[model samples]
Target: MKLKFLFFAISFLTAIHVFSQNTYVFLGSYNKNKEAESIQVFQLDTLNGKLTKITAAKNVINPSYLTVSPNGKYVYACTETKTPNDGNVSSFEFNPENKSLTFLNKQKSGGENPVYVSVHKSGKWLVNANYTEGSVSVHPLLENGKIDSLAQNFQYSDGSINKERQTRSHVHSAVFSPQFDYLFLPDLGADKIRCYGFDETKKQPLTETKNPFTKTDLEAGPRHFTFHPNQKFGYCIEEMAGAISVYQYENGALQKIQRINTHSDKIKEGFESSDIHISPDGKFLYATNRGKENNIAIFSIDENGLLTNIGYQSTLGKHPRIFALDESGKFLIATNVISGNVIVFKRNQITGLLKKVGKEVKMENVSCVQIKKI
Candidate 1:
């Protein structure tokens, strides 16, 4: 009895130590014609902010954007396009023990230049957005953690004020609401946030909502969106106009509350805003600016979900296309697509600011950063 009790105690403590030791980080990049691997895997040291490369998954085409399932058992990637109407989305089964991914299957994204992919809350549907062709598509998530088939494909035909950038439709992101009842597609060309009602029971997952869409500023070029943890408010980063739009969210409706600049007044001309994310505690917000300003705009969220500009932190690289806060909200990783570098920052939990952690990983055309605790 004494030996058995000691053995159980040792196993319990070992499990806890293993759980807190490592985090897996996955990066998606622009690898055209299988020139290089599309996805790179790394094991991040939670203690010293160091990343050790594990492996790379090749032959994935242009997986510019990726998302892991809620269960962390699978990964989904958007295979971007070189030609106009030939994009696809693929799935892989992730093995946590070996830190490897096995190719599952691929399916037509139902659009062109697929840029973003997201899985539904139920893990039963997958959605993607196509930039060049201005379309959105839904796919059924099979029981084996693979995407089975395209369920629905919707295209947008409207254009915004900018003639060159908004000549037609360019869907930038497809995000689901906090409740998972509706899906929002932000179209950069149309300058609107398109809404679709989601039904888990139907073969066709998405339908036009009652309030079909919400218009942004004529040339704001809404690109990425983030929702508050309380589900009462939301924010969108406008790519063209270099601003963030704050909104009060209820059911499927979004009422614009405020519009604020992501960059300061001095840096006015080249505003290529990229991504926005809220902290796990909902006390802070962060957005990335590209073009001439390669920095992250930090903001503090009030009790009412309003934002106050905190400050900015240089990303230490060029064209910070995507940035993400780790699950613990202790580290922030920014991927500079043009510079081929990933910069890591340590978070000040109290003040909601970031400082460089002195760890940078270099890769070719890195576009997406995602961290999962393993």
Candidate 2:
């Protein structure tokens, strides 16, 4: 009887391995010239957390931010260039079965240095942020996933402080609300989280009262923002301030509720940070700290939707510019840009801690990480 039970257990484990969908991770590559960069994909085993190379690094300029379409049939990214002289966005149709990517086309983002790109919930609009040009651009979609004509573009002239970093309005990120009614554009240089009512094709500015959106602290320089699954609370990661701020969002406006530092109050030196994400379970929040201190800050979201920094783990690599968690919440991956590698980590859901696993995977100038199911 004992022998038969052991055999059954082994059979179940093997079955689990065979049926579980492969976790796919994409690493954005930069060759330092902002040209000739590429996107690499890896297949992660759900049972053992093993990552296997699916797609080798292919030359595609500044595919920094990528999004797999709603149907998972295509992958889109920012080419971060206009053409001969301006900036634009690129869309690529992907074949998961063969693990190959085909170039679709490019559309002008209407601004320079397009750093952040996101597909709208409706799957009809692709929004982009021009970091250096301090503007926002929107592109329409086509049936074949090719980039269509430019739908709209907006630029704000105001800028914030930190003369060196915030000399001009640098819009770092643009995202949509849960209702798909408004767009959240975080301008690091402008010291504002501007709001716009998004329509089918164009978005208009929201009136102050009938909205749940408002600007943040003038000098905070917000880089990324994530909404609570409930859509009641939100968090914004401030790159310049090295902190995270919580807000209560309703209707279409945002009200600051709390602000917490992502680092320990130790000896002070400037530490630039990047990338912030909430776990799928919505129980934990994580942010990557760059500069001399390359670490991942772990925080717990309270009942009131405020974030309290619990601890931080060193990335075990360099310049962890971006990180992503597996779909099942079993593992996490962080991309080290300057070190030219990607590190895998096992996540403890109970404590919200990260543990290093296996070896540091080699890559080149990896800037972003995106995890999806096979």
Candidate 3:
């Protein structure tokens, strides 16, 4: 009777887990590059969704930003450095067995201080943004995780209004349009996003008569951006101006629609915009602000690919530069660089609000967050 009771209890819990579903989350680590505290993986389970520790703490250095191949086979992390010691992107073959990242070759980001990294939709190319040098580059992808070659490196020299930050152009972020037909690069110092025409056969951005699709505000210092999944529009977050600009991008050109403040009427003295991301479902957009105010400005994207402000929420930490929404879209992981922690917040998909879930995962001066699963 005792043996039967124990067996029944185990069976009941196992059945419950099976019904709940399986989910895993991987977190990047940031420290002063002592012994590499590899990217941390967690298990998350909740009514909103399921979560848990998929991989134990494995070792990787300053896995500051993460991107997975569209096919989900390859994972990439940007080292986020300026000096020759660390300015490179590393590729990984994820082993779900132990949640460990197998070593892959490093492709030197010819441009210094590369901050943002992304895999093009076709998985044929990889791109990097040089935050300090104000340059961008594209590299060809190989059948293996290694980069076949870095095909192009383009530098920006334009200067804008802001004297302090605009002393030199800084290409802060680079992203390809949903169709992978255009590349949008936000140069914070230059206060412009230079659009380039994409050519798959040539493997480069072209300067056509219809190209150089330029957009900006009066020294707005555009920092980061995201496109509406529908591909009808795009949005930009400006750090100097502290506002979000909505645009109509159709056919092959872009037209500015709206640019609205991320703050309330009461403007603080020192607030800089950091990151912007559109939710997976295409209903909500989020941008993080840092400085005197650290919060995420939320907006409701309409059917026409325009934006309406929902409001802002304190990220519950300091210097909320970059963040990530879990695959389930139930959690927003906010990385507070100054606070030295990454806090998880439960996101209400319907209401577009975030509430802190638990204590933050301690890190050291983290600059970005990328959430992946096993």
lDDT of each prediction vs. the true structure? 0.90, 0.78, 0.75
Give the per-residue lDDT of model 1 (tens digit) for 175-249.
999999999999999999999999888999797778999999989999999899999998999999999999999
Per-residue C-alpha lDDT of model 2 across residues 330-359, encoded as one tens digit per residue: 788998888888888898998999988877
Give the root-mean-square deviation of each candidate in angstroms: 2.8, 5.5, 6.5
Which runs of model 1 end up more than 4 angstroms from their true locations?
A: 1-21, 33-35
**Cα error, candidate 3, residue 227 (Å):** 1.2
The ten-residue window of minimal lDDT in model 2 covers 204-213
TM-score ranking from best candidate downward? 1, 2, 3
Tell me the RMSD of model 1 versus the true structure: 2.8
Number of the top-ranking candidate, with TM-score as the measure: 1
Clashes of each: 0, 12, 11
TM-score of each: 0.94, 0.89, 0.86
